[model samples]
Target chain A: MAFLKLESLRKAYGEFVAVKECSLSIGEGEFVCLLGPSGCGKTTTLQMIAGFVEPTEGRIILNGADITRLGPSKRGLGIVFQSYALFPHMTVAANVAFGLEMRAIAKRERRERVAHMLDLVRLDGFADRYPRQLSGGQRQRVALARALVIEPSVLLLDEPMGALDALLREEMQIELRALQKRLGITTIMVTHDQVEAMSLADRVVLLNNGSVEQVAEPFAMYEHPSGRFASTFLGKSNVLAGDVSGASVLVGDQELPADLAGMSGAVDYIIRPEKITFAAAGGLVRGQVTARVFLGDRWLYQLDTPVGPMQVIDTNVGLPKAVEGDAVGLVWAAENARVVARGAAS
Target chain B: MSRTPIALHIFHWLFVLFMVAPLAVVVLVSFTDKGYISFPFDGASLRWFQAIWNQKSFIDSFWLSLALGATAATLAVVLAVPAAMAIAWHRFPARDLALALLMSPLMLPAIVLGIAILRLLSHLGMTGSLAGLVAAHMVVVLPYVLRLVIAAAAGYDHALSQAARSLGASAWAAFRRIELPQLVPGIAGGWIIAFVTSFDELTMSIFVSSAGTTTLPVRMYNYIANTIDPLLAAISTVLIALTLVLMIVLDRLFGLDRILGGKA
Candidate 1:
């Protein structure tokens, strides 16, 4: 058994299901991110583990104990909320010491531990400052320190950096990842940002419409997504609809090579935008550049191909670039294209 | 206090004068040795203050009003905190109706509420009792409780309690530690509002109280009806001073300056 286990956990309100039949296992000290779009039940799933949301079915196990029926306080999971949720009236040190105070820890030890945790989050010398007096990033650090001070079994973060601006958020992500490793506490974070998940998690679980779509390592999830929804949600993709034939798929009167020697039927395939490279001469197919976007480090092109509208991303390292309305050929290794079974969601 | 046109400034001061000049006249008259209300350029004395102080009926009525105000406001807060939190934080069947009913007392006629409470108290065989009076005043002041507490609870992030719980604080502990401190200012504001409303209440108190249980407002109302003396002025002046002291203390505790014009 893993350190923490969720077995077919589910949650429903009236006739509507917010989370349905989710299961996962986490090893000791592993970092996991529940990645999904809004209303995808990721937060609900985390809440169930935190013992805030009652699961409609299944059991949650932690360290050989079944905690499915336990209350949130009994579960002893530390959670950093999306809004940070620091107590406005409490000073930074008091906020960090609250859980210890609740547990009736000795006052002297509690003070020492609070100071230690504050220093860990790089919030030294800010013990007496109230939350309102601190900036956004400072408040977030205080929240993290407060949650971690209790030495919880599992640290649950609900969009921990959602309130920060883009630059601060990116900075905090790297800093938080380093802090988590230093503590070596089991962690699960919920985020809608794919880059955050990819940058932080040892494993990512993608949720959609209250169901688990895919669960894999971040790199595996990006390179080998299990289905169409997972592929499109994780990164930009060009989905091609075609018929499987002998050694190739017939895509819009052109043969796109695939390992379909025995397969014969309609299929959908996903090619990541970055996988398709711009070519000067003949390649897999030709398309007209409908749009071009100059991202800081890369150029992204939207191509109107014979098969469908496709997107190709290229490194902006002085590579040959195509402008909008320019005709270009795109190619990639045959194995880079993936065949995906479509789910009901778009 | 923001900058405004001279005309608007004049209008603002005139409005203040219109509202406060009557109370100012009462204060001025109470300090005079004159037997009746007369204000301009009179010799001042503390004789009326000593007279009201010596009156057993006014003294009893004053203590009765204070006790009633304190109990009613405290009870209103006790009843309203959880109810307001539920109404503010949770979605349930009849939530709108529940809020509407809780807030309806603010709009309902005081005489109607008084009569309703009178009938209820009479039916319960507890008319004119201090306990019955407190209950009635709680009902009267409940709208203030709900309004202030709901506003405070809605502004508060409900997730703080959840975070506290996830940090191993039990429900009551979470409430006492995290939620209560955050609510102190709102509770203080609500208590002051409720106490003031209950202290000045006369529409219901006259109907509910017996001769022994008469409140200051009820006694003062009777005195003004039967006599024309500066004694009424003295009582009003005392109540006004008490209110001013309370407002000053509240301002010190909770910054009423921000309440007045912080937004503008």
Candidate 2:
């Protein structure tokens, strides 16, 4: 058994289901991200595991203990809310000391632990300042220290860096990841940002509506998405509608090379835009550039291909100089295009 | 400094003087020797203050009113704090309607509230009791407590409670440690405002007070029905001074501007 397991969790309110039959197993000291768009029940799942929201049907097992029915305070999971939720009235030391104080730790011991935790978060000199006196990033560090002071079993983050400015958010992402790695804590973060998820998680569980869509290693999920939504939502992908025929797939009268293993019948698949390269004359396919965008590191071209509208991205080293209305030859590795199942948004 | 508009400057001072003139006349008349309403008098004395201080009925009723105001304001705080917490912190069906009902007394005429309380108390045969007076006074002051505390709670980030709970504090502990401290300013403001409201209330006291339970406001009204005396002016001056002291206390504690929802 894993260190933490969500066994077939389900939550519903009257006629509407918020999370349906969601199950996951997390190993010790592994970082996982619940990645999805809004209303995907990611936050709800994290809340249920934290014991803030009770699961209507399922068990949350932590270290072989059935804690699904426990209260949040009893579950002893550290949660960093998006708001950073530091108490305004209490100084930094008091806010961090509250949990220790609640456990009836002696005043001297509580003070020592608070100072140690503050130093851990690099806030040694801010012990006497109120939360309102700290900057956004400092306040977040205080919130982190407050949660970590209790030595909780799991650290749950609900869009932990959502409130910071863009530059500060990026900086905190690196700092937070470093801190999480150093602690080796069993951590789960909920985020809609694919980059943040891919950069932080050992595994990303993609959710759609009230159900799990795909869960895999971040790169594996991106490289070989299990469904159309995962393929498109995780990163840009050109989905080609094709019918598998014998050893090849037929795509709009053009039988592009493909690895036709067990997949058969009508299929929809994704080819990553960066995987496609400029082919020689009489290439695997022909396309005309309909639109183009210049990113700092790469150039994106929206091409009108025989299969459908396709996107191709090429690095800007020496600048590809692909212009609109230019005809281009495109080819990709046969195994690079991955077949995925069609799934509904709902 | 490009001189602010002359018309705007004139309006500002005129507004200030308009507000100050009534209170100024009361203080000046309270010092007069004429024993009646006196402004620009030939001579002045503190004889009326001495007269008010020596009068046993006024002195006794003054203490009665003080105790009633404090008791009623305390009760209102006890009732309003939790109610304001519930109303401000959670979203339920008809929440606005519930708040409106809680504050309906503020919209009702004082005479109406007085008569209604009188009828209810008389039916229960508890009329003219100190408890009845405190109960009537609670109705007059509850709205202030609700409005002030609700405004304070409005600025609160409820996620603080969740963070507290996650950090191993029980629900009660979370509220005690995280919420109560932040709410002190509003509670103090509410108590002071309610105390002043109850101290100045007269319409309900007239209907409820018997001779034994007569409040200072009722005694002053009864006294004024026959005599024109500086004793009345002296009493009014004392009440005004008491209100100023309370305002100063509130300013020192929570800043009066914050009670009115200003960024102090």
Per-model lDDT:
0.87, 0.88
- The weakest ten consecutive residues by lDDT in model 2 chain B span B255-264
C-alpha RMSD between model 1 and the true structure: 2.6
For the candidates in turn, chain A alone yields TM-scores of 0.96, 0.96
| Per-residue lDDT of candidate 1, residues B164-213 (tens digit) | 88878888998898887766666767887899899999998889988979
Residue pairs whose backbone atoms clash in candidate 1: none
**Candidate 1 Cα outliers beyond 4 Å, as residue runs:** A260-264, A341-346, B1-3, B39-46, B93-108, B257-264
- Candidate 1, residues A1-346, lDDT tens digits: the string is 5999999999999899999879999999999999999999999999899888899999999999999999999888888999999888788999999989989999999999999999999999999998999999999999999999999999999998999999999999999999999989999999999999999999999999898888999989998887678888998887888777677777789788765435567777778999888887788899999988889899988889888889899999985488888888889888888765444334
Predicted model with the maximum lDDT: 2
lDDT of 2 at B112: 90
| Cα-based lDDT at residue B261, candidate 2 | 57
True contacts kept of each: 0.89, 0.91
lDDT of 1: 0.87
- Candidate 2 achieves a global lDDT of 0.88
What shift in Å separates residue A76 of candidate 2 from its native position after superposition?
0.7
> Candidate 1: deviation at residue B150, Å?
1.6
TM-score of 2: 0.95
